[model samples]
Target: MMIDGWAVNALPGVLVVPAVAAALLAILPNYRATARLNVMATTLTLICALSLFFGKPQPGPYLLVDDLNGTFIVLTTFVGFTTSIFSASYIGHELEIGRLTPAAVRFYHTMYQMLMFAMNLALVANNIGLMWVAIELATLTTVLMVGIYRTHEALEAAWKYFILGSVGIALALFGTILVYVAARPVVGEGVDAMVWSVLVTRAGAFDPALLDVAFVFLLLGYGTKVGLALLHAWLPDAHAEGPTPISAVLSGLLLNVALYALLRFKMLLAANPAAIAPGPLMVTLGLLSLVFAAFMLYRRRDIKRLFAYSSIEHMGIITFAFGMGGPLANFAGLLHMTMHSLTKSAIFFAVGHVAQVKGTQRIADMGGLTETHPVLGWSLILGVVAIAGLPPLGIFMSEFLVVSSTFAREPPLAILLVAGILIGVAGLFLRLNSIAFGEPRGPAAKAQASYVPMFSHLALVLVAGIYMPPALVVWFQNVAGLLG
Candidate 1:
């Protein structure tokens, strides 16, 4: 149960080691060596992550590895590994295209590892303050990567991401302090006051007023980072302008991590019977983002931006499921989160290839993809189908559960949910059909792409949809119960 003097705290240290090595490797003058080192380091991190899964849950004041975070740790590492592989090819092309210099690529690789570290730290941290710090670290790392291209547009996107992300994290920290203030009265001041387990156990005794105010700030703060609309101004630009691998990581991993932090606070609020209901706020925002992004999807001119909007829409659905706060709803939320992460990343992977092959990011210029690159086109089609919530894909299963749960509790909201899904489905299919079935529109495509990561993600999404292993269901069920 214990690997270090800290007793069972070893998992966290294992997570931190790669990030630390990555930081050290960042300063190396050799780009070739750094790139290979980056890949090797990420591979090692993935191995450690897999090893961590077999260990028993380690509960403590600073860190823990229960079923809830254990699943996330695996998901994070899996996505990280895939993204790193994709990045190697994508970045190589960028270098050839002169889109990135050797120095910038070095910085990108360095920041990439730092981002991985921050995400892992956020997932494992048991203390609220430390969790906030981890989220901030992740935000900073991504901001640098967002602007790596040094284009006018890229710089603008990075600047906006930095400003908005900083504001969001600041508000999150403020919220964290308020939670501590509320908890101090119940758990007493000092480290225990900010310990997640301690706060959850003593939540009922904390002042409801303080918890209410704190949740409001926390929701807006983390919701911004979660890419919820109204406050989601930063997300599309970040996704569209940034490198596609970073786009995949942002959509597939970082947003979920921010939302996880928000859900943890939501759970604390749930434990406090006297506190104001967090459901209405989450439901309202979820509905807003879903509705907003559904309409916005139709108007996207850029391929990447179009999929970025889809990410926003899917995040909204997950939020709505969690807001419903029933056993089935929460379970659906957990499943939706996983599916969206995999499906969205796959979509971006396909997008990256398409953009590179066609030599344009514009949606209008790229048509009849199937005629040119059948494999990439089919992959894109599969990805869009899975993401559009079509049947037999994991997303459809999750969306169905969400709608069914909403129908049981709130039929009117269920109607809205269906409407959003239908809109998204139509938009995606229309766009996909145009892109995949028409004549080849641009220069003949000819670049070898490692399709394993994209296809592999879609395959898993398919398997999870038709037949979720019982053990996985039990795992999510336990985590969902704990979340509430």
Candidate 2:
């Protein structure tokens, strides 16, 4: 690939802008100015990401771009931009109510930009070691923000996330080293073996045994961050205790970044005919997470935690779709990933507004939302319905594709997947009815949130379901083929 002049400059800007904004935000002191800067920086980054579609820098030892990651780059930056908008309004409320001090607000904005920078770096990275470093940077930034409240529960959640995230990072590092070792014989020693473009092109010649062991480590390691069932202990607490903006970004963008790393490896393994098939492991793990999260959903008392489990379930669906490894399944997986990101973040935006108005995160305390706060209530209802995979919504279309593709490939597994989806629907609607339609409970002060960001996401998702652009379908199809 040849580098265009515009892409050479633009690609670096995607990473540089957020980092510069973070440094400036740390010393700014004024909440309003810092917040606007956050939005502006994210907007610029999103523009850079979109520009990659027209032109891209040449692949290098440390950085690369392709159809697969190009899509992720756009999705990550777009969500980051909208979430920053939502965060500005959301955090301002916290400052008003004394939930956050000005210093904490500065710290939060700085970390937010840092997180965006890290995720953007991770998506664009070509070297396995560089990618690992980027992911760890993101984890640390989020850990700090998760505990920003300084409450006992917030601190504990941060601690748990830190410990689990450290273990995952360590395992991922080991896996990356093993991969370098595996590729060293074919690609030679040092950086050449670590570059993703080189590794995928040469994977078929590498030793199968080393690749197999390395993949096991990689999947378990990154899957932890992806919130696969047993490794998801930290997720609910992190979502429940953190500022809702962090929760939104965690579910929307961060998990997708981790999964993107795993998918890159999956492609490498798939290229090697001698290597063990990667699908079975991902399929098993995905199903386990989907079913486990679905059953767990009924038990969540915290509203944030409820949606957090929903994120896990949807991730499992995406994983399962990709693991199925066909044109249809891969397309579905891509669509599902995009839909879940938008819908889940929109849900958190609504939930944040609701928490602000009601002054609580407890679901038991929130009832009859339609009566007291119709906009928030109805918005939440639409978000919940879309997430539950109701028809004429983005999730419904993506999930339908997943299920239909699964049935064509394996009937028994399709049944299990459907069962999980239906169970999740029941649990969500049960909660939704109480929250949106019953007698009004708790204080119902009118929310002062910027409804634009939340509704904007929901509107996009709705339009996507009704009709996907031909260009997007072709793009997803090409990437799907690349996965196999």
Candidate 3:
């Protein structure tokens, strides 16, 4: 995983590979060729991201690679690479089934790479302004992809996402400006005022009033992107109507990217002793999102939509864990976020095939899946079992830590958290029963594509649940300590 000489340049490669690939895919003809090229480009970007471990780069005026973001970069690229593999098979079927056109898929491939580039740039960005630009770019790319199918539902979802996402970005931009203004007096105007590293070092002296207001806006803004409750209306529709691959990225990567931005600001607020404690605000929203999404999960009929709510609930858990900020809680939050991404994306992979095979996403239409397609059926069941915080799964370990830490520090909040988790579990298993076992219903046609990606992710989740490498434990512990 380590790289030696010349690997310092790998930082640029993470951004450059996807940017270049997007350009090439824009004109590339033929779905098969474009798809393989997409995978290759993403693989190269992942290699570049991994190299950051040994070839750590210095903080710069515009971009930097460091411990915290280095982990995020690697995860983002790895998932992007795997999702590309799934997208190839999924979209190929879409073409054959007339759900999409060759032209539409060409556009989809181009936007996919563009989205990866934007997310990478956001992660590596040293400047707040640059990060804002990168996040906005990523949002715009997903907006386009969300409507690629051009169905009425798809278009409506895209518009909803765009409108909501724009408002979120606007609030975020205002917060970014406030940060710069707060820093300008201390750090002296220009770019240095907006550099994230610079802001953290001098934040203690920045006006606490401005910092407080800035954080309020920043949380709501980025929380919208994170799909937190009260600000999460666009997420389910976007996930339900978009291509399944896009849904996977929405939950697995984009939400985390938004949370990353929010965490950076939380760190800034933490450095200032005079500023208000951010824990209460995040805790409130996190709990609200958890309870809210947990209840909403029962109302979902579309399979994709069901899991979309599950994502909101899991993000709530992660947020609540971080809001409770101790080394243990932060560590739990980080672990839960990673586990959720891997597990949820794997679910979407199975869900994608399930919807395709059954020719519908309606839960009522799919029954006796174990009898119909054992691999997909069981893979999805295992995914849900993992996501439900059951034992012997990655999420179980993370959720246990979250609940244990909460109980130790704040007993009442632990009760509420447990309530939400329990409700979510009941709702998910209720839905699972209808889909996984029963009298056969819907088409049982065998899937055309091999589901290696789905199984591979599940295998990782299984192993993580049982045992984690010492290196990963140390890495998460170090990052958790840094957050404090």
Candidate 4:
């Protein structure tokens, strides 16, 4: 690789390679060829993201990575790679059912790569403007993918997503500009005003009022995209109408990316003592989403929509954990975010297979998964346990930490949190009992389902719950300290 003089801290091939590869995928003649290329590109991208762990931290004018985003980079790429593998089987079935066309398949594969690139760029970005642009690019790509089927409902969902997302992105940009203006008085103009390292170093000297106002817009803007309640109208419809794999990515990956963007700004606020407290604001929004989504879960008719509410609920919990702003709570929040991403996406993988086999996504129409398909049945049951915060799963570990910490600090709120968890558990078990235990209601339609990826994820979640690695503990400890 020839490095430009300006690219002194150039990565060997991380960004440029996958970007160019996405364009290559767009013109591939056949679906088979394109799928192979997509997998290769995703795998290579994962390698690049992992390599960044050892790559030199380049705190420059536009892009850099230290401990802060390195973890997110790994999480994003790992999930991206797994989702692409799942999409391989899932998309073929959609095409056979005439839900998508060859052209659409080409578009989907190409967009998937672009989304991957944008997410990676966002994680590594030093400039706040570049980070915002990368996230917006990712949002647009997913919006296109969501409505790829071009159904009436899909089109409606896409339009709604576009409108709401546009507003949110605009607000975020405005907040970003405010931050730039805040920094310019101290750091002077040029790229320095937008660079995260420079901003953090000078944040203490910036105007408190500017930081306060900027955080509100940033929270509301990115918070909208994070699918918190009140602003979450776009979420369920998107999940219900889009392809299942895309639903998994939107819920698992996209939400995390948005939350990450919020945390970056929150760190800036944390650096300024005179700035308004960011904690209570996040705590309030988090609690609202938790309560709102919990009640909403019991009313969901569509299977995908049911899990969509669950995603909202989990995101709220993670946000609340972070909002508490202690080392233990922050660490728990980080763990929960990672675990939820894995478990939620795994559930969707099962849902996709079940939906394809049964030819329906209604909860009422599906029953007796054990009799019809033991593999999927078991997968769904395990996923429910994992997500509902049952023991011996990663989510359980994180929730335990949150509950214990909250009990010490605020017992009443902890009780409320537990109530939410219990209600979610009952709903999931009720749904699982009907779907996995009863006699098979739908046709016993077999699929070329790949259990390797699904089970692999659950197994990892299971292991993480029982025993988190020491290295991971250290990593989260470092990050949790940074969150303060």
Candidate 3 on 1-484: residue-level lDDT in tens?
2455556789899999999999999999889999999999999999888878886877998997878888789889988999999999999999999999999999999999999999999999999999999999999999999999899999999999999999999999999999998999999979999999988999999999999999999999999999999999999999999999999999999999999999899999999999998989999999999999999989789999999999999999998998999899999999999999999999999999899999999999999999999988999999999999998999999999999999999999999999999999999999999999999899988888658888888889999999999999999999999889
Give the clashing pairs for model 3. Answer: none
Model 4 ranges with Cα > 4 A deviation: 1-12
Question: How would you encode candidate 1's per-residue C-alpha lDDT over 1-484 as one tens digit per residue?
Answer: 3433342444755567667767777788676687778777787777777776566544678886777777787888888888888888888888888888888888888898889899999998899999999999999999989998888999999999999999999999899999999999779879999999888888999999999999999998999999998999999999999999999999999999999899989999999999998998999999889999998888788999999999999999999999989789999999999999999999999999899988889988888888788899889998998999888999999999999999999999999989988898888787777778876688665866778889899999999989999999998999888877
The residue-by-residue lDDT of candidate 2 on 234-257, one tens digit each, is 899999999999999999999999
Assess every candidate by TM-score.
0.96, 0.99, 0.99, 0.96
Local distance difference test, each candidate: 0.88, 0.94, 0.94, 0.86
Superposition error at 189 for model 1 (Å): 1.4
Q: After superposition, how far is residue 306 of candidate 1 from its true place, in Å?
A: 0.3
**What is the alpha-carbon lDDT for the whole of candidate 4?**
0.86
Rank the models by lDDT, top first. 2, 3, 1, 4
Over 50-132, each residue of candidate 4 has an lDDT whose tens digit, in order, gives 76666455577877877768788778888888888888889888888888898999999988888888888887788999999
What's the C-alpha lDDT at position 108 in model 4? 91
Give the Cα RMSD of candidate 3: 1.2
The CA-based lDDT of model 1 is what? Answer: 0.88
* lDDT for 53 (candidate 4): 63
